[model samples]
Target chain A: AQTIHQWPVAEIKAVGSPLSLGCTIKGKSSPNLYWYWQATGGTLQQLFYSITVGQVESVVQLNLSASRPKDDQFILSTEKLLLSHSGFYLCAWSTREVFFGKGTRLTVV
Target chain B: GDKVKQSPSALSLQEGTNSALRCNFSIAATTVQWFLQNPRGSLMNLFYLVPGTKENGRLKSAFDSKESYSTLHIRDAQLEDSGTYFCAAEASSGSWQLIFGSGTQLTVMP
Candidate 1:
């Protein structure tokens, strides 16, 4: 079975602080990785997606960037956090069917 | 305007009853996925469809790509079924990203 893990289950940061979130997938190789953000009581929005290591595509311009440093690892980070950046961030992998991780809850102060 | 729109925005059902959720897409969606977002903020993928119908336990989902619509039917609703249901569509003309609907908040009473 495949499993997805996200780090720092929750975080509270101040505006202008740098932020980094990580995700790792096990039991699956060369899977498509994606980042999605969902606000409280709102719909999800695709942030970024990577088909392979070293190549990530931006789906929305939220002033955030993602990188696939390794086949099983994906990183989402920003130089500075924004108030609007506070939300639930989910990491997912897919090969036809998509599965999501536990996700990270970010609160910007 | 919303690309993917879900109807009834909210619903309340009694235990052992059945209910259905619907999604309408304005884009040319090639695939549809149904998810249940729990109160704790985790999205559980329920179904992924490609212009067809699929059933898993008490849940059944159908996607009609030609009509750009999808439906999710829940049978014997239970307390644990209380959550927000979301439907996402992958458009044929865009990147392989899912455009999600606003979601339907469901409350299954015991």
Candidate 2:
């Protein structure tokens, strides 16, 4: 069975600090990967998705970027964190169906 | 303008009862997917619905492209079924950038 993994169940950072979040998929090959953000007590929002290595599409114009450094690895990063970046970040992989990771709760102070 | 909207926003149900959650879309949706977000903050993919109905165990979901809507029916709701349900749609343009509804919070009480 395929499984998705994400790191740092929760995070706290100051504004203007660099940020990085990571995701890895096991038992899947070249599946589409995505990054979704849900604000505190808010709705789910698609942030980015990638179909193949070195390619990603942006859904929302937040100050965030995603990269597919490897086939099974998708990364989300920012040069400097913003207060608005505080939220629940989810990493997912999809072929026929999308499966989400445990997610990382980011609290930017 | 809301491209996708979920109805009721919240619901309460007793165990062994039946209930339905709905999502109405303004965009020309080509595909719909339903998800359940538990209190633990994990989002589980429930169903990836097309323009028809699908059944799995005690749950069923239907998506209507012509009607621009989708419904997830819970049969004999259980206590473990309490959570927020969300519906996301992809336009015929083929962009998998799913636009999600606001979500409906369901509570199944014993």
Q: Tell me, by lDDT, which candidate is best.
A: 1
Docking class of 2: high
State the lDDT of candidate 2 residue by residue for B1-110, as single tens digits: 89998987999999999989899999999889999999879988899977999999889999999999999999999999999999999876457678889999999988
Clash list (residue pairs), candidate 1: none
Candidate 1 lDDT for residue B104: 97
* Shift in Å, residue B68, candidate 1: 1.1
lDDT of all predictions, in order shown? 0.94, 0.91
lDDT by residue for model 1 (B1-110), tens: 99999987999999999999999999999989999999988889899898999999999999998888999999999999999999999887336688999999999988
Q: Compose the digit string of candidate 2's lDDT tens values, residues A48-100.
A: 99999999999889999999999999999999999999999999988756689
TM-score of each: 0.97, 0.96
Error of 2 at A10 (Å): 1.1
